[model samples]
Target: MPEPLQIGVVVFPKVTQLDLTGPVQVFSSVPGARVHLIWKRIEPVPSDSVLVLTPTITFADCPQLDVICVPGGGGSDDMVNDEEMLDFLRRQAGAAKYITSVCTGSLVLGAAGLLQGYRATTHWSAMDHLAPFGAIPAKTRVCVDRNRVTGGGVTAGIDFALTLVSLLIDRQTAEAIQLRLEYNPAPPFNAGSPDTAPPEILAFMKERIAPFRQRRSEAIGRAAARLG
Candidate 1:
């Protein structure tokens, strides 16, 4: 028998809890998977939602993980300029079997220079930011480019995790897990995407996120310049 699979999910202030927890739940269900919630320290962290997550490991003590995942939210903006976090990711990604993210987490991976030349996806509003890191912005809910995998928006984490499990273990195992979780998705509204939303609704959504988008653009400019 071999060692259990080690999985690490990056936890941080204001991270969208669902983005982190959805995939964490799926991976934890794997037979030999051990998931670690990691941050700079072991402490309770708040999410954009009402949820509070606890980091179980510190970067200094974290073992090499089979998968290193960063989940996203407004906090992702803070992480773009976090040198320590970026350094840790760059180091871990150098040898991790899979480097991945959920939603805006890809922006953090991009900030760490891990997504360069890789095709990736993120929250629809922020997907354009990937270009600064030399990534091709994939227009799918889940995008996989070799060892790099990324998912779109918060709800997409479950789908991304299922796909990852299929690759890491087996399709049969993944299917069984999906069935066990009853992972069928049926949105009540057909407005999950810009293509499906009403024109006015889409415009309002864009307007709502404009300030964050502007800040992210500035942060990405700095992050990309540092990549040089």
Candidate 2:
């Protein structure tokens, strides 16, 4: 029998639950795949929302994984400057077939120096932070650069996972999984992105997230300096 495909998703305090859970849900459908929720410890971690996620394995005991994914949220601000977290990611990137992230998780990859010269994407609000880590930011929802795959924003994780599924297995399998999940998206409103949202709504969102953007920018600066 073939060995199980090991996939590890990093979990941390303040993670955007959807960012981690969406891809996990898709990955779980892959035949012979073992998905692990990883963290510094095997304990509960609170997300940006009310959700609480528990890590299945501690970072110290995590097995070599076929794929390693990082999901982003406000918590990423702390991780960008965290040597321990960055070190773990760097070690995993050495042998992992794919290094991927969802939402602001790409920022964590960038912090770890894993994304140097890779074309990647992150949450729209944090796109500008990519260049500091030597990543070429793409405007698309999912950006794939060789072995590096990054998804934009939270909801995009599902789309990103399906894309990765196609590469890992086959388009036929990915399509079947998509159908099984009934993954068609038809939002009641067209206010998903800044470009498509009404001017007022966009302005309001930009204003609302200004503090977070500023904090992330500072963290990016520190992470880049450390890389240098």
**Model 1 lDDT tens row, 1-228:** 999999999999999999998999899899988999999988889999888998999999999999999999999989988999999999999889999999999999998989889999999999789999899999899999999999999999999999999999999989998998999888899999998999999999899988988988888788888888
Residue 165 displacement (Å), model 2: 0.5
> How does model 1 fare in lDDT?
0.93
lDDT of each: 0.93, 0.95
TM-score of each: 0.98, 0.99
Candidate 1: residue 101 lDDT (0-100):
97
lDDT of 2 by residue, 135-218 (tens): 999999999999999999999999999999999999998999999999999999999998899999999999999998898888
Model 2 residue 139 lDDT score: 96
Give the Å error, residue 59, model 1.
0.4
The TM-score between candidate 2 and the true structure equals 0.99
